[model samples]
Target chain A: MTSPTVFAAVGEVGKDFFKERTTDTLPCQSTDKLFCWDWARENFDRYETPLRQHVELVLISVAIGFAIAFALALLSHRHRWLRPPFLLGTGVLYTIPSIAFFFLLLPLTGRGRDTAIIALSAYTLQIIYRNTIIGLDNVSKSAVEAARGIGMTDRQILWKVEIPLARPEIFAGLQIATVSTVAIATLATFARGGGLGEPIFGGELGIDFKTNIIIAGGLAVLLAAAFGLLLLWLQRLVTPWRRVETE
Target chain B: MSGLLSQLPFASIDGAIEFIFEPQYSNVTGGNKVGGIDKVVELTINQLQVTVISLAIALAVALPFALYLGHKHKFETLAIAFGNAGRGIPELALIAFMAAAIGVGLLNVAIALAVLGIPPILTNTFVGIHQVDRAAVDAARGMGMTEFEILRKVEIPLAIPTLMGGIRGATIAIVATATIAPLAGYETLGDFIINENVYGENGVLAGAILVALLALALELALAGIQRLLTSPGLKPRPA
Candidate 1:
C-alpha cells in the first residue's frame, strides 16, 4: 500500500519515464527508439534481476510444495481418514485462482516471497498428493508380501519397496508441478515477490511495451521450456525402469 | 485490511461492498486509472464472456481432433504433447505475446485464454475415448454396427464422465485465469487488482473475493453437471 506513488515510480525510473522515443515521434517505425532492444541491453539489470527472481521463486515454491505434499501423502496413507479431506482441501485450494489466492494472502502475510510461495505451493499439492497416493497404492501386493516374508518391517518395506516403485509417478507429478509453478510465478511481481511481471506490467503501464513485453514473455516461456526438459531428464534418471517398461 | 487505515478513504468491508456494487465514488490518488474498466459487475460479466468465448474456441479446435485420433488409435502423441506444452506456458506470457504481436483487444484475451483451455480438453478427450470399455465396443462392432455408430453409441456414452472432467477442468482454469484479462488491456475482474492503487486496498480485496467466489461456483456447478451426466452404472460410489 505504498499509495501508488508517482514519485517512487519516477525514483526507480527516470522522468522521461515512458519509453521516450516512439514511431510517432520518429520518422519511421524501423528507427523508433521507444522499444529499442539496445535500451533493454543497456538497462539489462532491471529485467535480469526479475527473471532470476522468477526462476528462484518457482524453484523454492516447488521444493516446498513437494515436501508438504509428500508428507501429506504419507500421512494419508497411514491414516485413511486423512486422505479424502486432504485431497478435497487441496482441490479447493487449487481452484482458488492464483491471483485471487495471492491477493487473499496479502492481508494475512502482507506482500513478498512468503505470500507468493504460500499461494504458488498450494497449486502443486493436488497434483503431487494424488500422484504420490496413486504411486504408493499401485505398488504390487506381492512385493510387499515378499518384503514381509523376508522379515522386513512395514516401515522398511514402504521405504525399500513401495517408494522405489512409486518413483516414476511421483516424478511425473513433480514435472507437472514444476511446469505450472514456473508459469504461475510470473504473477509474483504483483504480490511483491518480484518476478518477470515487471515488463509485462510495465508494458501495460505504457512504457517501452513492445521490447519489454517480448523480452519478458520470451524469458518466461524459455524458463518453462528449460524446466520441462530438466525435470523430464531428472524423472528419467530416477525412474530408469520406466524406459524399459514403456519399451 | 490496509484499506481500513485512516490515510485511505475507501477502507472498510462496507466500503468494499459499495465499491464493488457501486463504483461511482472514488478517493484514489492522481485519478490515474488503468484500463478504465470500472464497475465490479461489469468486470465479472466481461470475465465470463472472455472465458465462454475461449472455451468455445478451444473445444472446437481440440475436441474433434482428439475424438478422431482417439477412435483411430493414432497420433495420440499429438494431444499429449499439446497438453504438456500448454501446462508449461503461462497465460501471462501468452497474453503479453498476444498484446505485443497481435495488439490487444477482447479477441487477443480470448486467444490467450484458449491456449490455457485446449490442453486439458485435448488430452482428456483422447483418454476418455480410449478408456471406454473394450468389451462394449467389441460387442457393438460384432453386432454389425458402423464404426461411427459404435463410436457414437458405445464410446461416447461411456467416455462422457471423463470427457466432462476434462471440460470441467478446462472451464475452471480459463475462468480463473480470465481474471488477468485486465493486464492484457481487456476489461476483467483483474481491473480492480491491476489498478488497485486507484481503487484502493478494499477494492482490490473485494475484487479478489468476487473472483474467487466466481471460480468456486463454476467449479461446483461443473462438478454437479459431471455427476449428473455420469451414467448410473458408471458413477463411482461415495467413499
Candidate 2:
C-alpha cells in the first residue's frame, strides 16, 4: 500500500501521507479544486484492486441472487400458490437499505465480503424473481399447446419451451440486477468488503476528496454501463427471435 | 458458541431494542447519555424530510416533462436511456461527491437525492402514459374533449399505476439513500450507523432496525396511495 513514486517529476502527491503541508500548495492539495489531473495521474494505480473487487462483488452477488431467485421462481411456477408469499418475502428483503442491511446482519454474519454478498444478493431477489415469473407467465398458450401435442412432458415443456421463450425477459431482469449491483456494491466497503468505495469513503485521501470521489464514482458508472451492455448483448445472442421481431 | 455469541456487543437483540427506546451511556464522549426514542424520532424525521423533499422535487420536474413526452410519443429512447443511466449512478458516490464538491447541507443532499429520483419517475411516467390505450384517448377526443382535457381525464388516470410505480421506486431510492445522508452533513437515521464510535454496537443495530421499518412503512404507504389513485375501471377483477 505504499504511495506511488513514479510521478516525482510532476508533483509529490504520493509522498505526503496526510502530513501538515508547508506554504507550497498543488492544485490537488486544494480541496475546492474540482479535479486535479496531476493528482489523478499519480493516484490512478490506487483504484486498480478496488475496481477489480467491485466487479467481483457485483458479479458474485448477482450470480448468487439469480440462482436463488431462479429456483424460487421455478418452485412458484409449479405450485402457483407459493407466488404471492415468495413475492412478499423477497419484496421485504428488497425494501431494506444496504447500509442498514450490513449492520442488521453484523451479529450473525459479522463484517466482511460475506455479509456484503448476502445483503447485495438479497436485494436482487425481488426484481429477478418477479421478472422471471412474468416472463414465464407470458409464454404463449399456443406454443405450450403445440409442445403438448408433440407428447412432451411438463418438465420437458418447461425446460425446452417455456424457459427458451422466456429468455428475453429473464435477461431483462438480469440486466437491471447486474447494473444496480454495480452501484450498490460500492457500499460493500462499509462491510469491509473492499471495493472502489474504499477510496471514495476516505481510503487514502478522504471522503471529501473530489478527485477520488469522481474517479471511484466514474468507475462504478462505467462498470454499470459495461455490465448493462454485456447483458444486452448476451440477451440478443440468446434470443435471436427478439431481433427478428424488431426488424 | 454461547461464549462467542455473548462476547459480541450487538448479539443481545434486547440491547438494540433498549438502544431505540432508552438512552444509554456513551463512553466515547466521556460517559455522555446517547440514543433513545427521542433521538431515533429526530433522525427518522430528518430522513423522511429529505426523502419527501427529494421525491417532491423529482415529481415536480420529471412529471411534466415525462407526461409531455409520453403524450407526444417523442424521445422514447432518451427517456429509456435516462432511466438506465439513473440506475447506473452509485448512490454513495453521488452523496459523497455532492458533499465534497457541492458543499454539504440539507438542500444539497436533497438535490443529490432528487437526481436519483428523477429518472425512475420520468421513464415510468413516460412509459405509463405512452402505453395508455389509443382507443380510449380517441374516444375521449371524439367526445369533444380538448387535447389537454383528454390527457387530464383519460391519460393520467390510466397511467396512474405505472406513474405510481415510478413514484414508489423514487420513494424507495430516495429513502434508502437518505439513510446515508449523514455523510453529506445531513443527520438522518444513518448517523447511528455512520458514527458507530459514538453510538456503539447496539445503536448501529437500532439504526438498522429503524431504517428497515421506515422503508417498509413508506413502501406500504405508497402502495395504499397507489390503490387510491388507480381508476376503478382499471382495477383487477377476480378470475
Q: Highest DockQ among the candidates is held by which one?
A: 2
Best candidate per lDDT, number? 2
| Candidate 1 residue pairs that clash | B3-B11
lDDT for each residue of candidate 2 in A1-247, tens digit (9 for 90 to 100): 1111223411333234333233334656454455666778887999999999998899899999999999999999999999989999999999898888998887888788999999999999999999999999999999999999999999999999999999989999999999888988888888889998888774867788777889999999999999999999999999998889999
Q: Write the residue-wise lDDT of candidate 1 on A26-143 in tens digits.
A: 3222332325555566656667788888888999889999999999999988898999899899999888898898877655666788889999999999999999999999998999
What residue pairs clash in candidate 2, if any at all?
none
Model 1: CA > 4 A from native: A1-45, A202-208, B1-18, B21-25, B29-38
Estimate candidate 1's alpha-carbon lDDT, on a 0 to 1 scale: 0.77
Q: What fraction of the real A-B contacts shows up in model 1? A: 0.46
In Å, residue B139's CA in model 2 sits off its true spot by 0.6
lDDT of 1 by residue, B28-56 (tens): 65554332335666788899899999999
lDDT of each: 0.77, 0.87
Q: Candidate 2 regions off by >4 Å? A: A1-27, B1-11
